[model samples]
Target chain A: MMAVAADVPGAFERLVEAYEPRVKAAVARSINDRSSVEDLSQEIFLRLYRARQRYRPTARFETFLYRVIFNACVNFTQYMARRRALSLDRALDDDERGNALEPADPGMARPLENIEEQERAVMVRAAIDTLPEAQRRALLLSRYEGLGYEAIGQIMGLSLQAVKSLLWRARDNVRKALIPKLGEGPDA
Target chain B: MPDHERIGDGPVLSEAQEQQLLAYLDDRLSPDERSGVDAWLARDADLRRLLDEHRRTWELLGELPVPDEASPGAGFRENTVQRAHREERLRQRGARRRAMGVLAAAALVMALVLVLRDRPEPWARLTPEERHIVQNLELLENFDLLQQFETELDLAADVEALQAFEGELTETLR
Candidate 1:
């Protein structure tokens, strides 16, 4: 990131290579619009470029990058919602569908067991989607990004306590949803 | 023994304590803090149960869908870098144009001032009739002064003085 700031050749490209997957995954998790992921992720990188000069190393670069990704996904989601509201006649096309909810592998060599596992995974995705927006974002950042509450707070612009409360509620929500699906184990 | 030890440590977990336990399970706590949470969990059945629930919940969340590792198609990086470079060029161009505009405006004001200073008086641009109009402006301004004198002779003397004042005024203005 510092190298990119110094305008080193190929430095920005190195950043793109290193962080693109994480950025894409974050975008994919945040919004339901699957087709717009690529464009939204690209916009995040462009935003990073525009803000390169202003980049301060106050927190982890991943934290800063996720903040950028989070803001962009939120804006994109709101935009899509407005589009939907205004153009109710044009229902969502297949491309704009929740492709993220689809299992990664449709054809499993293990047949029945894999299908059952995949079904649980799909239910988990749906449960995550049903989480309140703030809780969902916090949960995704915590679990997927492995970010600490302080960093998540910084990214979400909430107090550390607020983030902790949010994550607790989010975890409880997911647990409730998963219990019936995953079965009554010792954890339940 | 377990109940007595747990009562001393704080039996009912607050929302924050519960969150801390979850964070501890996620390995978010430091070594010393983890040891403290470990002691608590060892002593309390309810706390241990809560920790187990949180751990399983986290595990299930880990199953959240991840997109396939397909490439973001060709030229994505190239296209983004090119657009950024183009935007930078446009921004710099806009700044330069703005600076040039300020310089042009300053130069124009300077040129006007120099032309007016080095060139003849503005009276030079006036036609004879216009000059006559200019010369009578003081008279128009002091027409009331002419009405104050009762005699025609006094009025003529005052008119002569006023004409001399107008000449001085035009010279000073020029």
Candidate 2:
């Protein structure tokens, strides 16, 4: 990180080039939109740059960076929430969070095919947006950034064992809703 | 999907098996362990399927595109460093100003106490004239306080300056 910061004129560009893709994928998988992923991800990296001189390589770069990205996305989710009145809280049914997969459409092929991968990506995003904050952050950090369990633990302030177990359950729960008819029960 | 990992031989993965599999997946296993896991995997179809599924999930998840790069912005580092520097300087300046203000107030109070100080009154109880002079000296010390603050402050000298008062008082005392 210090190396990246000291990069001088091209340092910020180098940071953007290196970590932008990972942060992009993390935010994309997290939110129900593609257009803002790049913009939000850049903000995270920009924040990193200013704080980089003080950066010690205590945690893996990916873990630290994703934590920032995760926060930025959550903030964005809240800010944009005012318009649609749609929110993670609103998405929850009265009973519990992971009750059943509520499909936004009744179509057979799923709307993703008709609207293009980008649009389908948005629906897939909506599914991700519904996860609890901790689970979502762990899942995204593990899946998109390729962080090891210990690294995820460090980022989320969880133990390694807890990270693995949490990720396992998070992935299982998300899969249940995202691929409702694709697999069997949660265990499957 | 977890059912895929249930091999016929073991109920749970041994440390060796766990290490072998994890290392093979990460491509960091020793050659012997590599071949061992490969051989173990070849015998167990369920294990193979689990590995395949894990890989597939990994690939599928990896396919989700990453964030976009907006330029980090103009003067981001410079602006942040400058702002912090200015704030810290202002804080130090404020602290120094407060210290000076406190010192000035304390000095003013001490000066006021000195100027208004009262001395022991001369009484009918037998008192030496020297004791009275000493009491008057104590009163004189209070007048000196004003001089400490302003070099040009002149005291209003009164009848104490008159030769007759000193002469008469000297004769009475004698």
Candidate 3:
């Protein structure tokens, strides 16, 4: 990032190469559609390049990158919301199209061997989808990305305490939704 | 771990204590806080159940399928950089074009002003006939006097009318 700031030749490309996989994964996790994933990933890089001059080192580059990711995801969600609202009139005409969020790649087999586990994963995803946007983001960043509360707080524009509470509430909500389906008990 | 301080034997898990438990699960609490939570858990099975539930919930979240690492098409970065440079170039070109247009407009206005400043007066530009009409504007303005002259010309109706016209023309010239 600092290299890009210094106008080093190929520095921006190097930066993109280093972070593209992580950013793409994050976007894929957040956004469902393949095209949106591609477009948003490109948009994120473009934003980074544009903001390179103003980039400060107050936070780690990953933190800054997460901030960009968070903003893009949030904006994309809002766009989706508006689209859903507009499509409400056509809801009756539209058939139940299954979530095309993740396309099946024959090359990649299911990570979980059991079909039941796959269903549970789906339930968890649905529960996560129901979470309020902020909580969902906080939870995903912590659980999946292994981001600490401090880093998440920086990305989320929240205090460390707030991040902790947000994650807890998010987990609690998901658990409440999941327990009826996945069941309770530590062993389960 | 935060110190387990109870003021007047309140409920075992108050809101603050709940936060502490959650934070503990998050591994955010200090040693004393951890001890405080452990003490509470040792005294109460319910709190332990709640902790377990939260922990399970956290674990289940980990069950979320890791999105496969998507490698963007080759030259993705190069293409992005090229697009950025292209956009910047176009923006600069647009700004330059606008600036040139503004300068051209200003120069045209300046040239016009200079030409007009160096040129002779409107009267000098006018033809001899147009100059004569401009000099006679006051006479044209006096409707009553011109009407009387026209009526006299009509009544005289001869060489005498011609003489009257000559007299009026000499007076108008003067």
Which DockQ value does candidate 3 get?
Answer: 0.42
Best by lDDT: 1
DockQ of each: 0.34, 0.10, 0.42
Judging by TM-score, tell me the better candidate of 1 and 2: 1
Q: Which residue pairs show backbone clashes in model 1?
A: none
lDDT of 1 by residue, B70-139 (tens): 2465777787778778887998999999999999999999999998789887888899999998899898
Interface RMSD of each: 2.1, 5.9, 2.1
**lDDT tens digits by residue: candidate 1, A64-107:** 99999989988898898798765543333433764323233231
- Superposed on all Cα atoms, the candidates' RMSDs to the truth, in angstroms, are 11.7, 15.2, 8.9
**Model 1 regions more than 4 Å off:** A89-113, A185-188, B1-13, B30-36, B39-44, B69-71, B120-135, B138-174
| Better-scoring candidate (lDDT), 2 or 3 | 3
Per-residue lDDT tens digits for candidate 3, residues A1-188, read: 99998879889888888888888889877865656766788889989988888999988888899999999999997898788676654553453453323333332233577887777777787788789888989988888778998999999899977887787778778867876676546574
Which residue pairs of candidate 2 clash? A24-B66, A24-B67, A25-B65, A25-B66, A25-B67, A38-B68, A188-B1
- The candidate scoring highest on TM-score is 1
- List the candidate numbers ranked by lDDT, top first: 1, 3, 2
Give per-residue lDDT, candidate 1, residue A126. 80
Off by over 4 Å in 3: A91-116, A158-162, A184-188, B1-15, B69-75, B109-174
Candidates' lDDT values, in order?
0.79, 0.61, 0.78
Instruction: Give the distance in Å from residue B43's predicted Cα in candidate 3 to where it truly belongs.
Output: 1.7
Q: Which candidate is the best by DockQ?
A: 3
